[model samples]
Target: MTFQLAACAEMLWRDRPIDWRASRLKELGFGVGLWNWPAHDIAALERTGATFTIMNGYLQGRLADDEGADMLLKSARETAAVGKRLGVHRLNLHGTGLGDGGIPVWQHDKVTGPMWLKARDTLNRICDLAEELGVTYTLENLNLMEHPGCPFNTTADVLTLVSSVNRPQLRMNLDLYHTQIGEGDVIRWCQKCLPWIGEVQVADNPGRNEPGTGEMNYPAIAKALKAMGYSGPVGLESNAEGDPEVALQAFRNAFTV
Candidate 1:
């Protein structure tokens, strides 16, 4: 079986329009991961004959409060609408940012319990919307050091969220970059998190650059996922070490199964 690779559009080809990003990646025989893109540009993306696999929907919001969780639900609804129209199935959202008193939502706090419950409710409702819209809502994990105050940090935490929600439409986006930083042993981590993983994002550890620029063994990571029967697109979500094309070439060479 063949798996796909999606380039993080915003992280590459800075000298062109949003539509051109996909076209350029297509020229390199690559797909794209969408973020901060307008729904109007979907036609332009389609014109490039590009493949769009995952889109970042909501980045920051409180999941525990009624007002905040409502905001997230509304945002997710809008994102699902746009993504469904564009034929994109995966809509990735960060669980939470920071809460009151500048405390992380995933950490011990006064409102953690209530907020967690609310996050659960909000995600479940979003899953309902996503199921109806023929889309999937993937909760993405971030690192504690890099993304301070990020709610979903550990791989286990993200897995717990998906398991707790218990919705077919709700899943996990295992960003290996963050995992490498927060929790090492990516190959084993990938295996453990395989069941709930709906999307995958990659970047080298130590430095958030292309695969070959840092300490990560891209070939091994790729091979591990493939061996586990994961056929979903693995997104290269990092800045180029030098030229984007060269970076892509290195990735292609290293990550091929």
Candidate 2:
């Protein structure tokens, strides 16, 4: 499994323009990823030589409601329109956390099973749309500490979503920082999420800063991912203290195996 480092432009070199950030990431031989679609700056990205790994997908609306299907699809189509043109291969999604009546989507009662089914069905539609555009969409697991009320915060929950949906386009965008906070079983969770793990993100615990800034052993974590045959890009989505150059070097050292 071959792994490459990707730079989350939003988290790095904040004072510069998007194109400058892209150029800087290109200079470091890192791929570029975005949490949000660069709708206003597609030209800036196109001018750079960096590869586009993933960008935010439709997540503003609830996926667990049948009535909200149109909104979700619209987001998918628009995301695909931008992604296909810009060559972003993956679209990352964060399903709606709040459901009808201002309740959490996964209440695990009369609504939980049906809501999950709806989510799965909606994802199938989105996945088909993604396949048509030559892109895959990932459902990410965000921890409760930082992202409360989110569905699929645990590894088991996310695995269930992917396995139940059973689509090639539906996969996991597993972030190590959130996992360490929510589950603390990084390697085991990676093993469980192996085949379905499409993309990875990392940040140290305690501060959510660059690797080695906190207690997370990125070296061992990287080795574990390697052993698990995760060949996708590992996104650096964390704060870089002081000079980004120094932080980048330290990140490379800790995450390079």
TM-scores of all predicted structures: 0.89, 0.90
Q: What lDDT does each candidate get?
A: 0.77, 0.77
Model 2, stretches more than 4 Å misplaced? Answer: 97-111
Q: State the lDDT of candidate 2 residue by residue for 22-130, as single tens digits.
A: 8888898788887666444887788786788888876455577876677878877877788777688688876564444334454332337777888888888888887
Q: After superposition, how far is residue 64 of candidate 1 from its true place, in Å?
A: 2.2
**Candidate 1 — which residues are off by over 4 angstroms?**
38-43, 97-111
For candidate 1, give the lDDT of residue 77.
75
Residue-wise C-alpha lDDT for candidate 1, range 90-201, written one tens digit per residue = 8887766444533465553133666668778888887877777788878888787865766655787788778899788888889899888888898998898888888888
Error of 2 at 173 (Å): 0.4
Clashes (candidate 1): 1
